[model samples]
Target: MSQILLIMASVRPSRVADQLADWIHARNTLGLSIETVDLRDWPLPMDDEPHQPKQEGFDGYRSEHTRNWSRKVDSAAGFIFLLPQYNWGYPAALKNALDHLYSEWQGKPVVITSYGAGGGGKAADQIAQVCQGLHLEPVPTRPALPLKAAERTDAGRLVDPAAAFAAQAADMQAALGELAAALHSA
Candidate 1:
C-alpha cells in the first residue's frame, strides 16, 4: 500500500487544519496508508546541532528527538502539508521540520493544503518553492481552504464539508492519483 504522510503545521487546537487533514484521510480511496504528524507534539529546539543533517546523517544527531524526527521523514512515501498562511508564508516550524531532513525528502511527492484569508495562496506558493528546492515534486493542483467558508459545528465537525471544499479536495486527490501512478510506473 502507498503511504501518505499528513504534516499538520498548525499548533492551534481549534484550527481547521486538523479537520481538513482528517477529512482527506477519510476520503482517500486508493488504499493509501495515512499517518498524521503534528509538529507541535514534537517540539524541537532551534537547530543548534554541530553538523548539518546532510553531512552528519541521522545517526550523528546529538539529540534523540531529532533522530526520531528524521526517521519519520525518511519512512514516508509522500506528504500532504497542512499549512496556514502566516504573513504570506508558511510557518517557521514547518520550514524547520523540512530543514531537518535532506535525503528523506528527495524525489518525494508533496501536496499542500493551505488555509487563511484568500485561501492561503501566498503560503502555498512559498511552500511549493521550498519543495522544489528540496527536489520534491510539488503537485500543481494544490487545495486551498479559506478560513471564511470553513464551518465548525457544536459537535466540532466541519459542517457542509464536502461541498465546502470539494473543488480543491478533488484537485488534490487527482494529483495524488497521478503521483501514485508515477511512483508505480517507476
Candidate 2:
C-alpha cells in the first residue's frame, strides 16, 4: 500500500493548512493511507543535532524526537506539505523538519497545498525548489487553496464545506497517484 505523509505546517489550529490536509485525506479513494504530522505537535528544535543523519544510521539517532520524525518520513511513499505563506516563504518550522533528515526525503514524491494572502502560490514555488535540493520529486500539478475559499472554525479547524475545493483535492490526489505509480515502478 502507498503511504503519504502530510506535513501540517501551520501552528494555528484554525489555519488553512491542516484543513487542506484533512480534505485530501477525506477524499482519498485510492486506498492510500494518509498520516498527518502537525509541526506544532512535533515541536522539533532547530537542526542543532551534532551528528549528521546519515552517520546516525537510518534507524539510529541521538534524540528520540529526531528518531521518530525520521522514521515517519522514511516510511512515507510520498508527501503532501500544507504550507501557509509566511514572509513570502515557507515557515521556519517546516524547514526545520526538512533539515533534520537526509536519506528519508531523498527520491520520494512531494506535493504542496498552500494557502495564505494571495493563495500562497509563490511560497509553494519556493518550497518546490527546496524539495528539489533534497532530491525529492515535487509534483507539477499543485493546487493552491486561496484564503477566500477556506473558513476557519471557532475551534481552530479549517472547513471548506463547498464543492469548489474538491477539484484541487482531486488534482492533488491524482498527482499523488502518478507519483506513487512511478515510485513503485522504479
Off by over 4 Å in 2: 55-60, 151-161, 164-167
Which ranges in model 1 have alpha carbons more than 4 Å from their true place? 55-59, 153-157
lDDT of 1 at 36: 92
Candidate 2 per-residue lDDT over residues 107-145, each given as its tens digit = 888877787757788899999989988889887777676
Rate residue 66 of model 2 by lDDT: 92
lDDT of 1 by residue, 42-158 (tens): 887788667777643445777788889888888888888989999999889899888876777888888888888678999999999899888888777788877667677886557
Best by the lDDT measure: 1
What is the model-wide C-alpha lDDT for candidate 1?
0.80
Model 1 per-residue lDDT at 87: 92
lDDT of 1 at 169: 74
TM-scores, all candidates, are 0.88, 0.85
